[model samples]
Target: MRVDRKIKASYEHAIDNLDKKEENEQLSEDEFLERANLRSDLQDLLKMEEINWKQKSRVKELQEGQSNTKYFHRVANMRNWHNSLSCLAIDGQVVRDGNVIREHISKFYAELYKENVLLRPKLNGLLQYDSLDHSQRDLIEWDFDEEEVIKALRALDGDKSPGPDGFPMLVYKCFWHIFKVDAMAVI
Candidate 1:
């Protein structure tokens, strides 16, 4: 209902000045064009947010399930997958201790990636496609809008693992209104 009201208001504003230019003309033609674009963009964003909310609700319902037993087993399986270690066999022995397993994995990967300083055949055109198309890439590199940043923060799963900073999505979402200006500036 709120979204419908907003859509209606925006539609009226856009249509009111559709063909006739404003007599006061405080805003330039470009500004008027931007206002017209805002109406459509707002409608599109509201629709997308509605759809995302519904999808999230459906996913939560499915995860909870009608039966508690099935939900518990499914969650346990996910936890196992997340915490599973790559069991490695080294020197005809099995190592399972946390530190030893980590060291073994590190050593294996280190040696696996070690470069050989030997003469090798030359390859031509290996760098093809290495450079991005500047024009095409520029399209995606625009600064984030405040609403876009907020939407991204809201979309992050609060239960998911935090990044290197150790701050979870819940923290960001909680303080979004306070930090939104600074966050948008950084973008």
Candidate 2:
């Protein structure tokens, strides 16, 4: 609610002075028109943020299920996929441990999102999911050795610097546990 009010106030200020010509009377009509459109664009952005904030209540409900069982199921699926990929890499000759293959999937996700946004058009444009040729192709399918993978996970849980690039790796460890205990299937 506070954010919404703040956003509304900002919009009112922008609308009150859409035409800069009021202060600098020498300004042309074209510049004034462009500034007016910018205010509209920012208003739309604020509206979207407010809607997303409210929608979060539903998301939280879905995530906070009957118990932590749902969370475990989510984790298990991820470990299964990651473990399978590790095994594939070992068996396949085409793919090795490429430089970008982070134990934490978040890093790659950020890269993909950043690249996708950079390649796409400006606001109101459709998002394009493009393949990133920047990193070398990885034919690896992931079959991380069971024991080693488990041990590595335990180590990662206690890792000193699992942070992304620089920031602390808080959520990374949480996911690691989710993958190790909840995601991994029993033999």
Best by lDDT: 1
Query: Candidate 1: how large is its RMSD?
Result: 27.6
Per-candidate TM equals 0.31, 0.23
- The residue-by-residue lDDT of candidate 2 on 1-187, one tens digit each, is 3356666677667766655447667556875776677677776776665566546544655777635555445544544554554522323443535443444355657766676656676766566667756343443444555676556645754546645556344454566556565435642
Native-to-model Cα distance after best TM-score fit, residue 53 in candidate 1, in Å: 63
Q: Considering every candidate listed, which one attains the maximal TM-score? A: 1
Candidate 1: which stretches are off by over 4 Å?
1-114, 118-123, 130-134, 163-166
lDDT of 2 at 163: 52
lDDT (0 to 1) per candidate: 0.69, 0.56
| Weakest ten-residue segment in model 2 by summed lDDT | 87-96
Candidate 1 structure quality by residue, lDDT tens digits, 68-146: 5554455445546646885666798877787888988898899998887676656686656666699868878967777
**Candidate 2: C-alpha lDDT:** 0.56
